[model samples]
Target: MSDLTRKTAAELSELMASKQASSVEVTQAHLDRIAAVDGSVKAFLHVDTEGALAQAAAVDAKRAAGEELGPLAGVPLALKDVLTQEGVPTTAGSKILEGWKPPYDSTVVKRLKAAGIVILGKTNMDEFAMGSSTENSAYGTTHNPWDLTRIPGGSGGGSSAAISAWEAPLAIGTDTGGSIRQPGAFTGTVGVKPTYGGTSRYGLIALASSLDTPGPCARTTLDAALLHEAIAGWDPMDSTSINQDVPPVVAAARNGDVSGLRIGVVKELGGDGYQPGVEARFHEAVELLTKLGAEVVEVSCPHFEYALPAYYLILPSEASSNLAKFDAMRYGLRVGDDGTNSAETVTGLSREAGFGDEVKRRIILGTHALSSGYYDAYYGQAQKVRTLIARDFIKAYEQVDVLVSPATPTTAFAIGDRINDPIAMYKNDLCTIPSNLAGNAAASFPCGLADEDGLPVGFHVMAPVMRDDLLYTVGAALESALAEKWGGVLMSKAPELVVNR
Candidate 1:
């Protein structure tokens, strides 16, 4: 592997700025890394070799002309397949949209391009972003770089896996539940879910309209923060986009000091279901924060326990409505159109052929939830629970600057372990669901590895809505302190993947 492939996005930018390396060199290095190891890691759904190189060349030319550039200019990034990039195939990991190239750029994509970042290609995801494991992807499961036998947490697993495996230093992920943070925890990378509506959702393949949040993934907190700034801001195209200044996340990440900051350890997120190693690492991270001069206290959000069920109900209901656009009559995967078949039959045939098991399951559950007799009982009740969860966050934030928890209950489970058990699969997001329910900013940073499995455990931090800078503050502090003990970033501890050629 080339040394360029291992450098952080920030480091790569500095190299380009100093004229020590051209953008094409950095972009090609990552492309080569993907070629060498992606066969084993399977992080990318598509590799836009030609497009990425061309973008890199343009950046190099602009730099040679002495034009101003952003901090992340010329850095290569992996985009989740759920986002549309004009003329690039976006599958959302389902056959329904297989080979569909969008005609326009998503707000996120437009921002990335404007920043002069090279688009590496689309990464795999759970079909329609439905499940917690990439096993639901019609393409294939994204294996954890730590252990190929285990899963890279999903529906944005490919994005996380790409960063973990060093195929790309940065990637984009959407968190509807725990998709970004859970996968970050499992892969020992940094993942951030900006405050809901904080990042524009325009052109993001919607899983749940209200819950879906596009965010950044990287091997380091500052790198994640840089990407977060590049993609986050007010967008006139999205009705839900927050009309406010993007938080000073990059500054907070650079600050990395938690001295005098009040940190809360959530009373509801630990014990019982949490693995001993996960809990051990989590508590140690808290102690480290306290030792670094932060005030630590245990806070309660009782409604968090109801977040999982409430999230399931709300997500599917929204997904059912959002996914209705794929009817075989408009675009993407058509079937039973032999000229004699009725429109309804063609739509049914296309849907049955296009959607995978998980997508179909959620659509049915959502349809039922929205049905006349059940809407008031199921969906309405879930909305009430969501409100309670939000209120719990509001109440807790009144006492604490931020809340902390184990990002997930355990390290990455072996692939297929919970695939057959839907309820078990759903429980993976237990600690993460409440944040999505509340529409607040949350992130996961690698604290330490679990002793039993020797896999990474994430230290999760939650800040109030729009206080995304605080999430970076806590993450950077933890990352710096932990790096001193480990002698390097936690990703350096991951087992190296065998190169293909």
Candidate 2:
């Protein structure tokens, strides 16, 4: 890999600012890295070589003209396929939308471009962001960079894997359940799920409208924070957009201190199902925080145990509604359009042919849940559980500045291990679903690798609504201390990918 490709987005930005390297050089280096290793990693669905270079060159020209620029200007990034990037093929990893180029950019893409960031292209994802593993992607699965045999967590695995594989310094991911943070834990990258509405969702292809949140993925905390700042803020176009000042995340990342802060260790998220190595690292991280002078205590949120069931219901119900737009008549794949066929038959043929197994599964479950007689029993109950989970977060936050847990129950599992067992796959998000259900800010930072598998384990942190800065404060502190003991970041320990010559 080129040294330029390995640098954090922050470092690359500095290099450009100092004129030591041009944005074109940095962008090309990443494109080259993608060409070398992406065959094995399978992290991206598309690679926009010409467009990325053009964007980088524009930034270089602006700098040459002495124009003011954003902190992340000239930095290259990978975008999740779920978000629209005008005229770019945006298949949310489903055949239904394959080859469909959006007419306009998503709010997230608009912000990234406004910051002068280079758009490398769309990364892979689970079909309709439904599955917990990228195996559900109609295109292909994104391999864990640490172990190509292992699955990167989904549905945003492509975004996390891109950064972990050093194909991109930064990436965008949407966390509906544990999509972003679970993958980050499995891949040893930083992934943040900003409070829902804190980041605009104007054009994100919705899986679960209420839960899908666009956030940043990077190799380091500060880099994630920089990307977070660039793409966050209110959007008049999105009714749910939070109309407040973006939390001071950049400042918190730089601060990295936990002294005197009250930290809560979630009582319900750990033990029995969690792997021993994961628990060991999580406890060590908590102990380390205590050593850093933070007051650590156990806090109970009993409702978290029911979060998984509630989320499965709520997500599919929302997904069933959001995915209704792709009914063959729209700008996606259309089938059975023979002159004799009725419109209904065409739509049915198109959906049956285009939707993947996982997408179909969710739609069926959701449709059943929302049926007139079952709606109150299933969907209504799930919403009530969601409310209770949110209340648990509210109650816990009252006793602590932030809450922490093991990002995943275990390290990266072998690809296909749980693909056939849907319930097993759903359990992967056990620790992360609550935050999404409650619409709070949360993140996963590399804590250490699991001793058994030698794959990375993530340290998860959750903060109150709009206190995204606290998530950074905790992540940065853990990253800084862990780096000292490990001699570098956790990704430094990942096995090198053999370049495809």
Candidate 3:
């Protein structure tokens, strides 16, 4: 039998429905894995085993009474700390809100509950999901499963690490820039950032609101699709959420033949500046796509060169406005002497003490960008640049079914290697960040193992807006072929973990 902790959500659901395993049994197995391995990985900020088991028991009771179960019934999943979970302290991996338990659940969390998935608890992240490495997390850095001294990509590193380490089969993560896909690439798991508004954002703590997206991080492409379907679609609270028909991702994953697919290689990425091993594997992935009868074509997006600079400007500007809401009086941790200080002083003190260095730097930079004279020069220009990038994707998609690129420039780096050189750290997302700027659907899965470090390397597959089902179709095909080619799943090659706990 597959290890319960590592089985994909689809497989677990089948076991639950067939009465071969109780929801509680599945839930406990995941909790056990977290207890066993996540300590060394440092994936979770917290793990709510009690609440998870309670929810599992409820699902078991429903099954006992012959009630109809939800499609992903009883699956245990984690929320990236950036999302609010009722009764759990929703720290955005920053000290500012360390003990603040949200009174309500994020829309994604609510929907997952309605679908009967148990909440395992919040995972760690870069503070406010701002950085490329989880080293920025106030709690501590999350280590890559492939090598403990290396980083799993961020700001979804916690979720990626958790899934890759076998702590949980699935988790929800937010992506702004390359947060989701890059982590998936680094950790050798599957992570998707659906088209903007493809998944609702209500109750998620804000981070570059226009660019922020929440989606699934899972062990397999099909499982990521399953979790996505459970939480996708319009929510009355989120005005941006599209009210269109949610696609049949699960069906698409199962029907994964890419015979007629047209895979476009973005001419802008995956050449120089990328690691030799990463480029080699990415080329092999293109060959695999070609072997599957895909019409391999090279397409150019001229404005894509502008993606990084524009992304930095716009994301920070929006983040400044969004984070302004975290004043001392309203929510989260408060500082300053209670009786002697005025609220303004307390607010200043609270913010000063709460935010991490990166968070403070962005806030200051954003503040300057949005300040009176610079608004038109910085933020305004970035918006127009965003428009140009979007237009580029629309034009590219006209000739290709989906776009492909190297997921990250290279494999995981040593924990503190690039932390001091912000630009160096930022370059890691060069190939992966454009999708966020364009608000399109994209996913990352292992393509091949990099010979340099024997760590997994990912190939990015992107589809036009709302064509997320295509990502799954392509991902499933590549995953199956690559696994067969590599002689096993990438995670099977991860070093056997020794749990400190």
Candidate 1 lDDT, 294-380, residue by residue in tens: 999899999899999888899999999999999997779999899999999999999999999888989999999999999999999
Supply every candidate's count of residue pairs whose N, Cα or C atoms clash at under 3 angstroms.
Answer: 0, 0, 0
lDDT of 3 by residue, 53-95 (tens): 9999999999899999888999889889988888988899989
| Model 2 CA deviation exceeding 4 Å by range | none
Candidate achieving higher lDDT, 2 or 3: 2
lDDT of 1: 0.94
Task: Output the better candidate (1/3) by TM-score.
Answer: 1
Off by over 4 Å in 1: none
Please give the lDDT score at residue 208 for candidate 2. 86
**272, model 2: CA deviation in Å?**
0.9
Clashing pairs in 2: none
* Descending-lDDT candidate ranking: 1, 2, 3
TM per candidate comes to 0.99, 0.99, 0.98
Clashing pairs in 1: none
